[model samples]
Target: MKVVIAPDSFKGSITATDAATAIAEGWASVDPAAEIVRRPMADGGEGTVDAFAAAVADAKRMPITVDGPAGASVRTSWLLLPPTEDAPAGTAVIDLASTSGIELMDRLRPWEADTTGFGQAIAAALEHGVSRLVLGIGSSASTDGGTGLLRALGARFLDDGGAPVAAGARGVLAIASVDMSGLRPPPETFVLTDVTNPLTGPRGTAAVFGPQKGLTEPSDIESVDDALLRLADLLGLDAQHPGTGAAGGVGGALVAWGARLTPGAQEVAELLDLAATIEGADVVVTGEGSYDGQSGDGKVPSFVAGLAASAGARAALVAGRITADADIGLFAGVASLTEIAGSAEAALAEPARHLRQAGAALARSLSD
Candidate 1:
């Protein structure tokens, strides 16, 4: 049987490529004669760079210094794909999550974190003369409504007192006017995002995601909401644009800067040529750290499964934890589903073993 393995990162347990490899290995052990193709996938979130780099040739890593989530100096990395003779000379892929990801901050200091480093990274990429920038916006820690990132790129946020506020969620509320004099124009920019939340309101940035960023109680919620409103008014932005709440309002800011916002999985899948990869496979396996209702909303695993079904291939999921009520049927040709372990701790403690087990179960089901 021709089998394709394409899985997202197992969160803290494994990389997407490694997850694919483990699944492939398990399938190989079960059916030694199986023809297996491995394609790692990401949702343009945390592992976007690694997934794209592994799939496409000529993508290289470039290291640069940027601010950490806590306003400290941190050395982070971004991907640099040197242009071919036929392509433009200055095109780069950037994952904003790499610099401002929630995972990058200390849990105790989430309130103090910001996205300044992400903006700095963008500036650095621009300095390299990159004409086209593809930025993945996910896993953010800041709820400053993207003001922090804008500030880093030379946009200044001044209070009514004409004093500069700090760069965090708390700082967003004090904005009286924005000074864009220091901003440099980029040729073109695209922001790949996985969410559709608006900038402000019940379904807005702070309400939907602030709690996850270490925000506690109704007061913290009110604080972030107020801050976002202030920033929106100061920047003359519509507070209700779809996807404006993405990455804590970074989506709206990018839109203000004329960046195109597309589904994260769709953009990454097209970039990786995922549809073409699935065409020849008899069965395809795709998954993530967790699979739930959110997976149906333009996530990587669902994207891969959709492609597999379109190509007349059976798809399966191998996730670390599968929520009981998740609609697995959305993955139309997904013939099998397997959770890595019964719990998170077990999965993390022995990811390789659990992956092999999941793979074996899938192999048996497919062969049956």
Candidate 2:
């Protein structure tokens, strides 16, 4: 029998790699002869770089320092994959959360935060001569329509005086024109995200994501949303394009700079060659920190289940917390920390141990 253990990071607890290890150990305890495969997964968020580092042989980490979301400095690293036939010079992988994510902020600077740090990292990667770029643009801290990122790449966001505007959403409101004459793009670029929102409108960036970044007031949301519309107009971006509203409109901005937007989970699945690994598996197990209704929308668990079903293998999902309406029908079996640990607090406090327990339980039930 063969079992593949692939899971995403349990946020605020264990990483994807550790989760996979713990599960595999438990599975081994039950079926020592079963072939086990461990694959850690991420959907273009915080753990993106680590995912590639673990899966790709000869991958290196390139360290750099850049501005943080709230005007501070942050030390982070991007991943460099060794040369391939498609990208002979190599490929650079960057996660926006490492440099410009809301997690880096002490307090939300909703309007003042920007994507400058993300842009700086990208610039550094370009300077290193990478032939292609893979950018994970999730967990952003601002809704500046990506003006700050464009600025770092030499695209000017000018005020009425033809001078550079301030960075962040405030800059978005002050922009008189946009200049892309000095912008530099790599041979190929992929912007990884799961969002499909428009650039600006009732369902756009500010309206949907601003509150999470501290822009809760109706006035604030309206102001930023309008500014994003202005930014789009000046950039000649289609506000209604799918994914244009991702990362506070960074998706649209990257599109303007010649980058393609891809569904993060599907993109990562291809990179990991998940389907090929599931072809002969008896059962495929996957997991995440939380399993909710939204998990069905391009999240790791749903993607894994789809691949397992295609390969004629039963799929089991294990998560830290599995909500009541999480579309449990997608998996043949489901295990959650809340049920195994008796409480959410206990589960979070000792996630690895509980994850192991869940794995053993799944193995026993599936083997029956």
Candidate 3:
């Protein structure tokens, strides 16, 4: 029997790499002779680089220290996929969650957070002469309309007196003009995200995502939204463009730099060559932290199930918590660590322990 295991990170509990390893262990324990394969997955968030590294044998981790969201030094590495015939120089995969994500902040610095680290990482990747850039814009810590990122890329955000403003949303609210003369040109950039919000207004980043980034006052959100509109006007780009508001306006910033927005799951699947990996498997297993109503809308499990359908294989799921709204019927077999552990707290406290149990149950379900 051949089994392919692919799972996204269990969020705060375990990483995709560790999850796959645990699942593979459980499967191997059940049928020691089974041919088990692993291909961890990510949707352009925290584990994107890890996914690429696991899938691509020639992928390299380029370590660099950059200024974090709160202007502190952050240690992180971006992935560099070795040169192929199509890309003579190679490709760089960077994820915002690692460099400029909320997890790095000890306290909410809504007005003080920025994306400088993300852009600095990108600048380093560009310096490596990569032919293409794949950026994952998720888990943002600021709502500065990408001003911090652009600043690192040589774009000057200035006030009416031609003086540079402070970093973070404070600077975004004071922006009067922008100078991109010294900005570096990026090669074929592709932004991976699922958000479709525009750059301003009620449905925009500042209005919709600002609260999560620590925006407390309604007036503060409004101020950031107004500044983003001004930035949009200065850049001569559409403020209402879909995905422009993703990652607290990092999506819009990349757009201004000539990048294309694509669905995170689909783009990541292609980058990891998921369809090719699951092609003739007898049992294909995939999972995530939670499976809810939104799971069908381009999550790892649904995409893996679709691929299994095309490959004529049975797909199973092992989620941390499966909600009532999730369409569990998509998978031939399903296991929830929460249910197996008898409580969500227990499941979370020891996710790997329950994950292995879930794996074994799913393996037995094949006979039932």
Candidate number with the higher lDDT (1 or 2): 2
Against the true structure, candidate 1 reaches a TM-score of: 0.93
lDDT of 2 by residue, 102-186 (tens): 8888898887999999999999999999999999998899888988788889899899999988888888888988888999865
lDDT of 3 by residue, 142-255 (tens): 998888888899999999999998999998888898899999998988899878899999999999999998997998888899989998999887999999999999899999
Q: Against the hidden reference, what TM-scores do the models get? A: 0.93, 0.96, 0.96
Cα error, residue 87 of model 3, in Å, equals 1.3
Tens digit of per-residue lDDT, candidate 1, span 134-215: 8988888878788778887788888888899877877776777888888776567878888999998889988888878877
lDDT of 3 at 135: 94
Cα RMSD, model 3? 1.4
Clashes of each: 0, 0, 0
lDDT agreement with native, every candidate? 0.80, 0.89, 0.89
